[model samples]
Target: MRLGSLAYEQIKERLLEGGYGPGQRLSAVELGAELGVSKQPVMEALRLLSADGLVTIIPQVGCEVARYELQEVQDFFALFASMEGTIAGLAATRCTKAGLRGLDAVSARIGHLASETDPVARSHHYRLLNREYHARIHALAGTAVVGEISHRMWDLSDFLINTSGADHPLHAALDARHDDHETIRKALWDRDAGTARREMELHILGTLSVMRPQQL
Candidate 1:
C-alpha cells in the first residue's frame, strides 16, 4: 500500500479498536511517530478519515475523533434499512449467478463464525462477512446513483458499529444477524424480489431493536 493509505488503515484500525475515545484529539505528529511515518502521510490519512465522518478537522485547532448522537444513530440505520431493502430487491432480479455464489460463500462463512467460541474472533469475522454480503448486493443492484449513496451510508454505519460498539451480548447479536442473513440469502437465491425486500427491511429494524435502549 502507499504510505498514506497504509497510515490511514493503521490509524483507522486504532480508532475502531478503541485506541482513541470519542472526541479525543489526535496529534498527527504523535500518530506519525507511533506509526513510524512522516507527518505528511499521517495528515493525508487524517483528511481521508475526516471525509468519512470518523474525524473532525479544524483549520487552527487540528483534529479530533467524531461522536454520534443516539438519534443520529437511529436515523442512520433507518435510512440504511430502506436503501438496503431496495438493493436487496434489485439483487433478487439483477444479480448474476456468480454474484449469487459470492453471496452464498459469505453467508457460509458467517454461519461458521456464528458457531465460533471466541467473541473477538467471531465479531471480527462476522464484520467481514456481513460487509461483503451487503456490499455485493449493493454492487449488483445496478443503480448507479443509489448505489453510490448506499456505499457512503454503509461507511458511516460501519464506523458507528465499530466505534460505538454493540449494546447486546456479542453472541446473541451474532446469532440474530446470522438468522437474518439466512432469510435474505434464501430470498435472493429464489429470485424473490418482494421477499428479499421485506426480509432485509425486517433484518435491519430487528437489529435496531436488539441494540441497547440507550444506543437508540
Candidate 2:
C-alpha cells in the first residue's frame, strides 16, 4: 500500500478503536504528522470516513467524529437486532456442517477468554470472537445486502462499545453476551430457525437494555 493507503488504515483503526471521541475534531495536519504521513492522504482518509458517517466534514471547520443521539442509538440497535435475527434464522436454514464447525471454534475461543481477569483484555477478546462468530453466520445466510448492512451497523456498534468508558457498567452485560452466543450456536446446530432468530434478537435487545441508559 502507498503512504496514503497506510495513513488511511492507521486513522481508520484509531477511530474504530475509539481513540477519537464522538464529535472530536480530527486535524489532518496533526494526524498526518503523528502517523508520519503527509496531509494529502489524511485528507483523503477523512473524506472516506465522512462518507461512511463515522466523521463529519464541515466545509470550513474540517472534520469531527460523528456523534449519535440517544434515540439514534436506540433505533440503530433495534435495526441491528432485526437484521441479525433474520440473519441467524437464515443461517440456521442454510449453514453447512463446515460452517457450524467454524462457529464452534470461535465460540470455544471466546469461552476460554471469557474467564480472563482483566476486563479490558476480556472485552477486546470478546469483541473479536463475537465478530468472527457473527460474520460466519452472516456468510452462511448468503445475502449480500444483509451482510453489507450488518457490517455497517457493527462498525457503529463497535464505536460505541469501545468508547463507552472503562467502568461503564455495561461490562457485565458484555460478559453475558458470550452466553447468548452459545445459545445461538446451539439453536443453529439443532436447525431450529425460529429459536435461533429469537435468541439472537433477545441477545441484541439485552445489549440495548444494558447500554442504553448509560449512553450519553
Number of the top TM-score candidate = 2
Candidate 2 local lDDT, 1-216, one digit each (tens) = 987778877887777667888889889999988998889999988887777678889998888998888778778778888889999999999999999999999888887874677766666666666788899999888888989988877877777666555343334565587788989999999999999999999888676655545674
Q: How many backbone clashes does candidate 1 have?
A: 0
Q: What is the Cα root-mean-square deviation between model 1 and the actual structure? A: 2.3
State the C-alpha lDDT per candidate: 0.80, 0.80
Error of 1 at 57 (Å): 1.5
Model 2 lDDT-worst window of ten: 163-172
Provide the lDDT at 31 for model 1.
Answer: 94
| lDDT measured at residue 13 in model 2 versus the true structure, 0 to 100 | 71
Worst 10 residues of 1 by lDDT: 163-172
**TM, every model:** 0.88, 0.91
